[model samples]
Target: MTGAVATAPAARTGRAPAPRPVSPTARQMRRAGWWFLAVPLALFVVFMLLPMGMAAVISLTDYAIIGDTAWVGWQNYARIWDDAFFWTALRNTARYTLMYVPLGLVVALGTALLLNRSYRAVRLFRTLFYIPVVSSTVATATIWYWLLNPQKGLLNVALGWFGIDGPRWLYDSQWAMTAIVLMSVWAGFGTNMIIFLGGLQGVPGDLYEAARLDGANVWQQFRYVTLPSLTRTTFLVSTLLIIGAFQVFDQAYVLTKGGPGNSTVTMVYYIYNKGFGSLEMGYASALSFVLFLIILVFSLINARLNRPGDGGRVRRRRVPAAVPSAVAAR
Candidate 1:
């Protein structure tokens, strides 16, 4: 037994070494995680991050499609600052946003309110409104192009019935942006409508009942209850709409090519022409960065403005009417 004990100590002391310091399962899990992220990370690096970096580099150079390039050191941006066409496009985009965002909000909110009630065709109506949102922008543009055609178009034809000749829509510089705004609203409002519907449904039923009991009218209740409650959704929708409006491209591209005296020219279309048509890619990249900065700033502003109870970028809604009918009766 004493010999066995001494032998056991010797055996333990000489044990073949500690197990290899490794966790196969943990290693395998880490490998699997990388594998899982490989696709999106590769995609992001290639498509988004790489493009942005390349664009930034390009912006710094006086790069061109043909001939050896030189780094002009903000020359393109300096030129962009003085370019009248750039100003026109920027102005046009601002006007487009001013018109599009508010108009879109009104139509979407109104549609949502109309559809909020229980009705037989409510589901169908929801789907109907949603169809346009999913519809192809190119197809919508073509349809609109036809409808707004000066002579035989549906819009002008209808105007003739009322003894008023509608002005040439797409052909006229004055009416071109307006026409685009109308169609854009038609295409874009449905999504916001759905968002508003979800918000309205989420509003507390007891609040409505309380307002009713206090004798608040429909509009009053909407002002006091609905508008205030729907703030976050409205803010998001408005910001999105504003951003999209600033980046207006397809309609301007397809409809008028920014023509009829450059009326509907937008920043994106201008950049596109510079990059592809003129092959002034360096200048275009600069324009793109400027645009990106502008968008980021405004988005940040809108976000800041929409927060609760702070003197911020947006004006908060206030309504003063909430005493129940029962309370009044008493």
Candidate 2:
């Protein structure tokens, strides 16, 4: 009877009720969710992933963007090792990084420390300081080109007033790269200043008071308290500055066009000249990958060098605890 009750319930219900179909609203919602995800996913695949894949594939070949592509696996990479221009560009980039990173850090940290007060005009000063950051790179380059002008520029004119002869800046190979570095630091320090300011704010005020109570002087307090607190911020700013210094191209393009003697031909400028001016896309791609490896190695080294508790490369020694005065007397 129970089996019959279970078995015949559908039969007894006559023609078993048809399964309920999904509501139009529910189906529409499902479709909407899919469409919403589909657009960005499709864009990511098409724009980002596809281009990277194409670049990687092309880097192995000899494709000039106009003719047949020949697969010459690793040949482009081998050529990069032998390219003198590549080495020169790498050296210039390294020199720029060395000059820019330290100068940028010092200026940014100094400005941030100066503006870390509670005065009313601080905000106004910060806005003025950061105005250069917001200014277009091209505009800044053009203005610097005028300022560094060999004859009529304001910089040399100011130096002339002091009875000092200023060297030709952008026109001279020796000074062209230095001029670019100075201009970059001026236009770029504001962003790092803001970052350092944020880090300064995060430091505990109580630590300063404690240091003062310990009879620590201003320099001692700064060395022990402020610097220790700023390690992470310094690492962040240095990494960013290094990356930017390596990729510098726009200023070179606008001011010197990588001349007076390729003094300002950075890695990116080299890549750009190879890719566009020389029309060697495959070789250009290979150069780009080399630069990518160089950047990755430096970045990894920077990270390792600045990792927490590394003391920024100085090892901290554990001093033995002092013996009791009574024990010493015995």
Candidate 3:
């Protein structure tokens, strides 16, 4: 009986024996994949995660560039609440964002609408518009300075034709922010216009055809079909414009120099002054964290407003958010 049991396969088919069962190779391969990810994981930890942790630590201390860093445990944050300069900078940035973003959206959308039609030189026109975005900010600022100069400016000369008094665009505190707003809109509208143009193209033509068949006019079709479809693109463009307006530095740095009595001073310029100019790295670091928090809050508000169910949502982006809930959508 024992011999029969051991030789059952041999007895049945005259085969020597069956080979031992092997483990699933796919599971082993999956296990191998864990090790394969180790390098990239390590790099993310070292480069991204490590730096953020260090910044958070530095934000808690009172370290200057040349002196010892002392931990006062939220004192920096407390100080920020009472800082008038910080408040002014924040207010200025908010005003700048409001002025530029709405005007930019309107102008970009209008331009995009015009360019959506057939044009022979559409490519050239598009390039001409986008040239400023890729050009150096310093160069653009310098050109703007000459164009908006108080006495010898081309704009004021044009104003002379209308017999209307023009403001000293770059010199007067009242007009300084206004001039910056105009320059920002001109420089930035092109990018958003291009984006909107691309979005308009993505809108299917069949909808327009169907609307036309239903006796829909251009305005009606756009109001019903076009706007609904372009919601996502509009949201994306608005968020970008808002963020850019908030973070404005280069133009203010080169043109107004945060002046006409700090009327054009943005939060970033304020932070830069605190960090490098005054050598208060710790205070600057705290300010940097506060700026980060502000950005984070705005970003959250943007995303929340733009989400699918939120009525006025924009397109979801490929870039990750800077704060929590960046993972929630996933």
Candidate 4:
């Protein structure tokens, strides 16, 4: 009778049992998660999305602070094409990007390589390298300003020890942009170095061991293993460099004021002059969108060039026949 009773439900009904009710603890935790997420989501909407919407609307209107606002409807964008100063600023910004991105990548990757070891003082050196990144941009520029003074600055004084005359960095148009590039690299490379370090650490120990077993030298192992592994990190760093290069304003304003004949005038600096200096908010907004588009295009190009599969395929083809089956498997 007991067995029949136990089997009666399975024989009489085929439907599955209902799900268990939510536990009070789990419900409370779920609510807490939403509450936690709401804070950053609210902040993002308020600070980022709202401002972007406002700028888009403002870009279509002539809204100088002291005058009646009028709808202009793409006139400002049209004007940008005819503005010679805009092109010059763009050219200067491009020149800075060209110099800064490669040098920044090299300095960052080199520093990461040097520090990617177990040592007592490694953390201290990393902290020292990162100090410039956390330091205020204006303060850093001010320091570099003093450092680049051709007459008595530390840089030129060191040059004097080597019997080489240093050029007037900030004061000379020819070297002003280069000086800014150097300062930018020094101030920013620490962040990229940390990123590279993270990427380096993620690389498999087995890959290096296999490379050594295959008679690969230091450079060959780096080329075949480390570089391939770090492709995404490189793309991330380079894209950031390009965007920051375009939006550069603080260092130029603090160090050179876009001068020694506007040689250091960047897109953001020019936009700042238009918006605040000349009270052309609409035009500046238009320029901002244009700069955003440029950044977008360049980032897409960088992503396409650094696609993981593309590099992986090439590397696979390049792997020497002498490499062992174990290395090939990795």
Q: Which candidate leads in lDDT?
A: 4
Error of 2 at 312 (Å): 9.6
Q: What is the C-alpha lDDT of each candidate?
A: 0.85, 0.87, 0.81, 0.90
The model with the greatest TM-score is 4
- TM-score of every model versus the real structure: 0.82, 0.81, 0.79, 0.91
* Winner of 3 and 4 under lDDT: 4
How many clashes would you count in candidate 1? 7
- Which stretch of 10 consecutive residues in model 1 shows the poorest summed lDDT? 311-320
Error of 4 at 112 (Å): 0.4
Alpha-carbon RMSD of each model? 8.3, 9.5, 10.0, 3.1
Query: Positional deviation of 148 in candidate 2, in angstroms?
Result: 0.5
Clashing residue pairs in candidate 2 (N, C-alpha, C atoms within 3 angstroms): none
Question: Can you write out model 1's per-residue Cα lDDT over 1-330, one digit (the tens) per residue?
Answer: 998886796687886645776699989999999999999999999999999999999998978889889988888889888998899889999889889988999999999999998988998999999998899999999999999999999999999999999999998888999999999999888999999899889887877787786678888677666776787788878888978988889989988889889999899999999999999999999999999988888888888877634321223223222445432222
lDDT of candidate model 3 versus the reference? 0.81
Candidate 1's C-alpha runs over 4 A off are 1-41, 308-330
| Candidate 3 least-lDDT 10 residues | 321-330
Q: Order candidates by TM-score, high to low.
A: 4, 1, 2, 3
**Which regions in candidate 4 have their CA more than 4 angstroms from the true location?**
1-20, 308-314, 321-329
